[model samples]
Every structure is written in C-alpha cells, then in structure tokens.
Target: MKKFVLKPKIYFNEGSMEFLKEIKGSCAFIVSDSVMETLGYLQKTIDYLNETGIESAVFKEVRPDPDVKVIAEGMKKYLETQADTIVALGGGSTIDAAKGIIYSLWQFRKAAGEEFKKPLFIAIPSTSGTGSEVTNFSVITAEGEKVCIVDEWMAPDIAILDSTCIQHVPQSVVADTGIDALVHAIEAYVSTEATHCTDALAEKAVQLIFENLKALYNDASNSCARERIQNASCIAGMAFTNAGLGINHSLAHALGGTFHISHGRSNALLLSAVVEYNANLNSNDSRYASEKYARLAAVLQLPARTYREGTINFMQAVKDLLKSLGIPNRVRELGIDKSKFENKVETMVELALHDRCTPTNPRLPSREDLVGIYQKVF
Candidate 1:
C-alpha cells in the first residue's frame, strides 16, 4: 500500500522564466533573501511577472534558516498587498519562505471569511540542492527548534529549473549544496518507506550526482554539470519527500537548531556516522539494508562483495566525498565545545525521536541508541 503525490507543473530550460508572463494572477509577491537580490535575480523575476500585466511586491527579508518570526512578518506583508500569487526566487531559503507564507496565508484567509485559494507559488531555485521547490516540506525555526511543515497543499504550483540560474554561485555553495542533494538520494533509496516509484527516482538521482557533483564544484560555469545537478536535486527531493529520510537529517536538524551550524555542513558531519550506526542494526538478516549498501557502494565503483564490506566501503566513500568538497568531518571541528555537546545530547536525542521524519526510518532508535550514536559522532 504505497501512495504518493508530486503535483508540481515544472518547466525546465535556459529561459523558463518567460512562462511567468502567461500565468493568470492579479498580483505576484516574491519571497527571497538579500543575497538573491544582490545577484539581480529577484528583479529579473519580478520584471517578467509584471510582463503578464500583474502587479508585484518583493519581500526580500527571508534570512538563512528562516524562523517563525520571519514567516509571520512576511505573511503580514502578503496581507497588506492582498497578493494572490507568489514567486520564490533563489535557493532553499527563499523557497522555504514561500512555503511558510503560503501556510500562514491559508489560515488567515480561512479565518477572515475570504476565498481560501491556495497561493500560486512558482519557485526558481538558484542552487542545485534542497529541492525545496518540488516538495511540500518546509523547515522553519520556531523557538530555536527546527520544525517541519508537511501539508500537501503547501507544494508549489510551478517549479522552474533553469540551470543558468546557478551559473554565478560561489564554489563553496556549489560544493555544500551538491553534497546535500547526493545525501538526499542515498538516504531515501535506503529508507524503509521507499516504494518502487521512489527507488526509481533515487537511483537515477544517485547516478547523476556522482557523475557531475565534482565537476560543478571545480568549475561553476560547466553548463553540462549544472544541468545534471539541477535535475538530480529535483529527483532527490521527490524521492525523499515520499520515502522520507533517516538519522542524518534528524541529527542535522538538532545541530542546526542548537549550534546554528549550516544545514548541509551539519549533515556532512553526521552522515557517515549515522550510516554506520544503521548498518550495525542489519545484523539479523536485514537483507534490504544490506542490499542498499551494496547498491550505494557499486555506484561509487567499490567492490562490495559482502554486506559488512559494502557498508564500510559506502561510509568510506561518503567520507572521501565530503573531504573532497572541503567540508568538516567532525562536530568538534565546527567550534563547539565538548561539554556543551554532552549537556545537550539528551535533548537532541529527545527532539529527534519525535521528529516527523524519524518514524519512517528503517532502524528506529531507542533512547540509548540515540545517545550512543551522538557519542560516536562526537
């Protein structure tokens, strides 16, 4: 009994932004971060939207790791203009802000007795990761905890994947975000909830990412790599949204909330450790888990002759990938002290146990298991 939903009308190419002019809407509000505005992408998006004879407003205050306060403020701006549609431009932050605004607006309109039309959101991702455009999940910080919003209605109406949008991204961003997309594919492929549909998507995503992530990291202007990574991100997003993620994301959320670490880097630090932890649980003839490691190792061109060897090689490959991307490999390398991490380990474990994504994990952890995993990463 596997059912899923991926309802976005996507347009991809060099100039898909031109499609904005044909969308029927009264006004289009854009949600973005300061960096996107500096790059002139936001203005370009608004100019095209206005070509449709639609009025537009820009809410360019979406911060990195956007919080509930920011979402509430953006919603107030949305209400002031009574905008009927939204254009999210930039990376994960901008697309995430758009989701927050949509969720808030839905509630407000319902309470005010207005037509509760779902805002028409068109996402133009400027990076090749997070795949926030295609999925209905939005992670917003509330009271220092990252919370997931999972309403199917929050999925964007249109997703524009123009690889040219990522042409000017910094090398560091290219490396971090690219690894994040690869992690998404690998994690979802091994998920307990993974269906045939998700497995197909995840396998393709993994193949594409391994083929192009390094090229993109070294040469941002490589158009071929850009397109491949862009497609990989969307595929990974679709797979993970339906199949769900594992301990890597669960621990990353906690680290991001407590230490204010970058999301991708946090995941980079814990991914291999978490993979090892889960692999250890497959001792009792968990053939599915063993098969997952074998497949992943094969993708990396490793000799996976046995389950234990396969899992070890997979973890080694992940570690090598992060090192090549110049990402820190340990939690302590991020400048956090040991005492603080120890003190907060219990709380982090508790929060992750209740996380929306944890239940679908192939090997659900007990409290002791969570504590042990944290210690291993530490």
Candidate 2:
C-alpha cells in the first residue's frame, strides 16, 4: 500500500522565529556558515534561545555541498557542545551538513553499541529551495561525487519559516531556488511512486511556485510572495519526501558535483531537458507522463487542449520562466568548457544511474539515454 508521511511541526509568519523562545531544551547547537553571521541571523537565533534560558554553542564552518570529511568534524563539535537541541540555521547546505553530522553520530553510536541521545532537531531555512528544512533527505559530497541520504529518523522535529529570514535574499538566488522547488514538485507529481495525497501536495506546490516565484524574484522585499515560495518549497519537500524524486535530481546531483555549480542553478539548467525527456515529447501519442504534464499546464492556465499540446506548452512555459529569471537555458552559458564537460559525460552518467532518485523516475534511462540528456543540456 502507498503511504504518505509528514513531519516537523512548522512555525511560520513574520515573528515565527520567536518559537525558539519557548523551546524546552537546555542547550542548542546552532549550525550554519559565515553568511548567517554576516546577516546577523546567528545572533538573533541565539537571542531567542537565550530568552528561554537555553545555553547555546555555535558551529560555523559548514560549506556548500557539505563535504563528507567535514561531516566527521561537525560530529566532533556536535558531541563537544553536549547540546540537547540541534538548530540548523541556514540554507540547504547548512541543514544538510547538520543532518550529516546527526545521522553519522547515530550510526556510529549504534554500531558501537553505545547510547545515542537523539537531539530535538530544528531547521530554519534562509532559502526557499531544497525543502531540506522539512525533509528527511540530504545531499552529501565525497571525492567529487554526490550522494543522497534518506532516512526517516533524520527529519527535523520542528521547522521555522520566518519571513525575516528570506526577505533579504538576492534576486538571482530567489530565481534559482524557486526553480529547485518546481523541480521537486514536477518530479514528485510524475514519479512512479506518486499517490493521491502526494499529487495533491505536489500540484499545490507547483501552482504556488509558478505563481509567486517571478514576483518574489523581482522584489525580494515582497513578503507575501516570499512566504508563498517558502511554503511552496516546504510543500514540495513533503511531497517528494513521500512520492520520491526522479532522474532530474539524479542528473542535477551529478552535474553540480562535477562542475561545482550551485545545486539550485544546476537543477534550473537541467529542468526543461529533463521535463521533455520524462514527458516523452518525441513520441507522437501522449501517455501518462504527458497527461500529467498537460494537467499541470491547465493548472497554470496555459493553452493545453490536448495532452501533447499541454505537455509542449508546459515545457515552453518552464523555459520562458527560466528566461525571465535571467537563468542560463544552456549549459554552455555557464562557461564550462565543452571539452571538459564531454570528458566528464561518462562519469556523470554513472553517477546519475546510481543516484538514489533514479529508481523512481517515470522512464528508466539507459547509459546512452543519460548521455543524450547531458548532451542536450550542454
């Protein structure tokens, strides 16, 4: 039987950061990179915990992609703080790093036959992408290869979505991350494992992201738009966490890890190519995937009378959206040498094939199929 799951009590709205003030934990270990400190959110989070008399320590060394070696180091710091609460206080990378640290410790303690005190995990997202705040999934990189880790026990106990956290995001970042949420929603909606419940959540998230992302990207100070995108991101996260993702993520992980591209940007670049591949647009007749894409087009109010027409329109719509956001539609625009990328094609295909997200893809891809996708994007 197919089952849907949701977790992590969410606190949102303008002053939702205040939720930390009521947390009953004795100590909080805040995990983030230097950006939070530069933006002064680190101090703000500590102040909220301080109001509740919860002492806190900081681990500020996290980097993007969450290198596996550093995860071990973070575990050392996590233990050193003796924290009962674990607060992830940045974007997806920071949260993923925190998850890596927490999950690693649990595995270590279990293997050693020692007691493991599971901390009450809290995630505060500074970006509207990855939905890492609400999902039991994380991406970790080791030896220039990316791996997705999924475990029910790694989900946060609470998620705080304060408007103040996202109100100052860069417009470019807004575009990239918003598209990341779109990828999650669309992938989940067409996933082989999708259920009625996941479809509902994914559809809502898709609608929200399409409607609000452009506005939010144009004006970072638009609190209403920001909240909508944030909510959409989390909703998409919940949907994919249950419905599962597909080869879009698998390809994205490979692309980002190989080229050092930001995950959001990587996903945005690959989205249209992946959509076309999954929807079977090259075929004359529409099928399940095309029908689903057509339905999503109808939701967006695009002209989609026939399933094939709807699917084509939706693909173009995504391309139009990416263009409006100033995102690069072609991989060459990112300035990666064609020769280098070609050289990495085999490795990318291998990584994508082995990715945890690949199994749930609507279409089972062969080696040549993955190579073709890379070439099309390139």
Backbone steric clashes in candidate 1, count? 0
Worst 10 residues of 1 by lDDT: 281-290
Who wins the TM-score comparison?
Answer: 2
The positional error of residue 67 in candidate 2, measured at the CA in angstroms, is 0.6
TM-score of each prediction: 0.95, 0.98
All-Cα superposition RMSD per candidate: 1.7, 1.1
Q: Candidate 1 vs. truth: CA RMSD?
A: 1.7
lDDT of 2 by residue, 59-101 (tens): 9999888888879889898888889999999999999999999
- How many clashing residue pairs appear in each of the predictions shown? 0, 0
Q: Where in model 2 is the C-alpha error above 4 Å?
A: 284-286
